[model samples]
Target: MVNNTDLTICLFPKALSIPSGFVTLGICIGNVFVIVSVYSIRSLRKPCYIILASMALVDVLTGIFGFVAGLLFALHGRFFYFGDTVGWLLHKVMVSTIALSLLHHLLLAGDRYFAIMYPYMYIIKVHNRSVMLTLIATWTIVILGLIVILSPYYSKDVQNVLEYTFMILVSTQMYAFHLRIYCKAKKTAGQVSSSTCQAVQNNRSDFKAARITSIILGAFSICILPSLIHSIVIETQGECGRCRLPFYVCSMLAYANSMLNPIVYGISNKTFSDSYKKIFQKIFQKIIRLC
Candidate 1:
């Protein structure tokens, strides 16, 4: 007779496990490059790239947590291989890191918004120290908030409600901020004086940064929304037999987001892309010397 564990194992086929392993690896490797490029390149040591580096750090943690969970799932063919408590802890950590990533996106959007809309203020107020403080504050708030929401004091339903509400609010604010930035850029395009070539150049650079961030935001939204909706459906309707496949799909999509940001950065930002090329060239040279 087939046991329940066997059935569970069957549900999580090797097909899913194999791809998940690859995706987790991709997330870790891609984000590591982002962090290294940002750190090694002196030009990237600015407030904007600083925020991106922090985001990459958070994504690396997210990838680590996902890898651990996926390893257990792959080994046991079931989740929470270490038991429910450990599993829930891992889940909370994953959730928190993802929340941090989203918050970082929000920060990036706000950073660009201020840079373009209130350039004088941004120049005066936004610096490495200020950006670091904002990042620290963001981390503290999200960690504390997650601890509260995921605490045993709240029932599962309450936890779900709170999480959903937080995600929605943050996402909405990000959208609004990016929209304003878009409008501001459009309105100011013709107003910049051709006489001040430096001013025009600066304006163009700011807009380019804004455009890259917008693309990142769009990729994040597209990747995460399906997972968000899936969670809502699972909570309200409960998981049916058919839910298993969609659950895997949604999860992979969510995990894919961590890997997408670095790709977007490489493709959209010339500085980052150039750094990537140089890094690869150096790595190749090292391998050749070793041989």
Candidate 2:
């Protein structure tokens, strides 16, 4: 295990500035695209898009506060030095944003599952009011998670255990449920084609939605799961020196999740993708006409 002093000296600001800055920029841009695209396009407003928009909003904050703050810290070689209170606040904000994002992802999965598995009930029962309630619940859970993480009552190991266990269980169960829904939808689609072309089209659309949801979930896991495991191991071992580099890399990867989400979730949907293309084409057309 390298000492903190050695870690700081080796990862000097001059050596770290360029790469971290580039990464922060990329993440911010991707998150911004999702935010802007969703807001500008009216057709994209639906329960599913509401969940995705919530996720993108958090991702934007993550890019701005989490990655951008980290970039500044790296550039100045502050290396986790923001004064005690400020550092604590930033820590809470960063962790809470991440937790909120995970909650949004789960809500998105639930949205897709219900929409597919129970379309009629979903249409009647799930609406803007329900979306608002879901958002409130998401924030409430994030707040509680932050409180537990910040509280001194629980040992760090205990906190890590709780967080990891909750995340793993929720994520695994959500994915499994989504997989079941997708399979059932697929089977139904295969059996119902003879009934009507409309039924087949509806089934196809459901399959597409499920496929996109699964892709987003897969991307999220790829980006965040490593950091989660690393955090658990570090907290359990109570030694961060050897884990510092890996943890930092994992953190960057986790931040990258925010960047990938908009592209994966937003652009994958036909409505959002079409809207994005139209907006860009209009801009280019105006430029050509001016020329």
Candidate 3:
């Protein structure tokens, strides 16, 4: 329902166009590597990695859509060409992708939580099939939720309330799950001395995975909180002329999360780091042969 005139009135500075383009490109390329690594590396085909790959896939879409939207914004200072409906849908899809990315973080945290807190059951239940089913369900729910929110039945206020509620619930659950995981890992470490060597090794592996996931979760929280707060303020107070710039900055920060995630995974997981190296080596060799 946003018109071009209103959009142009609050257009982001043209100087931001290049930097935003680069960031969006990085987001797409980085997440593509994540998805490829997860699929190609047999070792990374576990539940946690599957969820991570799914998240990366969503991020790729976000970056692509965001690039188009940003390009339009920067070029014309508004989505003048797309008309209201298409432009509105593009923005909504981008928002939905971000929501999907956050849900995947929760899914990743849950995977780690169960792996650490209930290893036996986790081994039995959290396989490829179950993970796939869970992802399908998540996609369906989010898509349906987006449809309901976008329907004319709900006012803008209602949509904002629903979004705010969803964000809080997901953030709370993810934090709670990680907190329980940390407590469980600490307690198990104290008891490790009496355990068998194999058990200890397994415990260490689980703890390591949990730690890496925690880092990703922390990064997501930091990146998203600014945008979430800015959004709430804008919704409640109505738009301020000065607030527009800050909102754009906050949105860019949120977009930065997609770029940061792949780096975190590579740095935190030796397996992913090695896979990246191997992929680069292959590409290098191919270029050399071509030359």
TM-score of candidate 3 versus the correct structure, residues matched by position: 0.91
In candidate 2, clashing pairs total: 0
TM-score of 1: 0.90
Clashes of each: 0, 0, 0
lDDT of 2: 0.70
Ranking by lDDT: 1, 3, 2
- The TM-score of candidate 2 is 0.81
Give lDDT: candidate 3, residue 248.
69
lDDT of model 1, residue 216: 94
Error of 1 at 250 (Å): 1.2
Ranking by TM-score: 3, 1, 2
Whole-model Cα lDDT per candidate?
A: 0.82, 0.70, 0.82
Best by TM-score: 3
- Model 2 C-alpha lDDT per residue in residues 1-291, reported as the tens digit of each score: 211221122232445556666766766766666667777878666677767777877877887786646654755556444433455456667868877887787887888788778877887999977897889888887888787766656464575567677788878877877887877876786565666677466656666777787888888889888988887676577554433668667766887777777677556777766765776688899999999
Each model's TM-score, in the order given? 0.90, 0.81, 0.91
lDDT of 3 by residue, 12-110 (tens): 666667878888899998899899999998999988889999998898988888788886675667632344566766766776887898799889889
